[model samples]
Target: MQAIVVIILILALLLVIFTLQNAMDITINVFFWEIKDAPLVIVLLTCLLLGYLIASFYFFPKLWKLKREYKQMIKFNSELKELHELNHKNDRKPVDDNSDPEGIELDDDDNDGSTFFKD
Candidate 1:
């Protein structure tokens, strides 16, 4: 896993370097816009900004709701685990080794007190 991540990081760095070496001009018909002397980094940054803007306008509210619900579910599950532990602790009872049949033994100080059933 670590090797794969390092390889991916190296590849991404090489891509960034390659892109940064090529500065280009672009034109947009939607806004009748023309950009001059724009580096690839700048173009990428603009695209990222526009993408975020579109997402915020059309998709962000629903994504935010889902994130909030995920957090709530995690909290509920943690609380449930605590509650289950507490219930299990309260449900345990003391036992006596003398109640066992042959071929079985129990330590006096053992608090678990689990009974072994014989067939």
Candidate 2:
């Protein structure tokens, strides 16, 4: 923050020096209007401000559209994540220990055509 303040102060000093050096009076002639004895710095600053405003106006709509699209994508992603979690939860089944009626343990790895039950 201090560095930014220093840089801003330096720029302000430079602007002051530039304004003092360019404080000459000049006449401006527009299409149907004529202005006399205008400071060169004020004219330049006004033109700069006007150009900035025009550029901002031209790009604001696109910026707003991108912001809205970004918000919609975030909402869609959250909804998809919620749906995937719900499906994952529904896919899992709880194991029941008392499912066997004969009280026998079943061996699932009996591959050699052995007995289907384990003692």
Candidate 3:
């Protein structure tokens, strides 16, 4: 913040110096309209301000769309993370090593493809 203020002060000083040095009167003509005895500093500053406004207006919609997309992506990412966490929590079921869920059991000594049914 202090750095920004210092930079702004320096720019203001430079602008004051420039305005004092270029305090000349000039005439401007556009089509049939004529502007007489206009200060060079004011005209230049006005042109700069107009250019800044024009550029800002030209890019405002694109900037707004990018912000909207960024917010939507953040929301989607959070939802996906929550869904993954929910699935991970629900998948923590205990397993039984000794008992099989199916009734059929395989015999280790027999090489034949035969399954024994539990009694």
Candidate 4:
């Protein structure tokens, strides 16, 4: 970013020098109207500004559409994540209060599903 700013400043300095050197007066003929004895520097700068504005008009609509699409995708991804979390919450089985922490489930049955215990 700093480099870009430095380059722009250098270009602007060069443009100033070029404009000063080319300061000859010139006449412009528009449709049924004539502009007389305008400075070359002002003409060049005006043309540059107009060209920048025209190019921005060409590109800004597409840029705005892409930005809108990016925001929509982000919203969709967040909704999808929320739904996934909700699904995981619903899919979980309810814990039994009588179940052992060691994962061993003991009922009345013993060996061979028999309730009798030998002493």
Top model number, lDDT: 2
| Tens digit of per-residue lDDT, candidate 4, span 5-108 | 99999999998899889999999887998999999889888999999999999999999999999999999999999999998997999989999999997676
The global Cα lDDT (0 to 1) of model 3 is 0.92
RMSD of each candidate?
A: 10.2, 7.9, 8.8, 8.5
**Largest TM-score belongs to which candidate?**
3
In the predicted model 4, the residue pairs found to clash are none
Instruction: Give the residue spans of candidate 3 off by over 4 A.
Output: 92-119
Candidate 3 residues 62-103, lDDT tens each?
999999999999999999999999989978877768665694
Greater-lDDT candidate between 1 and 4: 4
Superposed model 4: Cα runs more than 4 Å off = 1-5, 88-119
In candidate 4, position 113 carries an lDDT of: 62
* lDDT (10s digit) by residue, model 2, range 5-119: 9999999999999899999999999999999999999999999999999999999999999999999999999999999999899798887776776757765676776764544
Per-model CA lDDT versus the true structure: 0.78, 0.92, 0.92, 0.92
TM-score of candidate 4 on Cα atoms, chains taken together: 0.61
**lDDT of candidate 1 over 11-55, digit per residue (tens):** 999878867676665544446666555566677777889999997
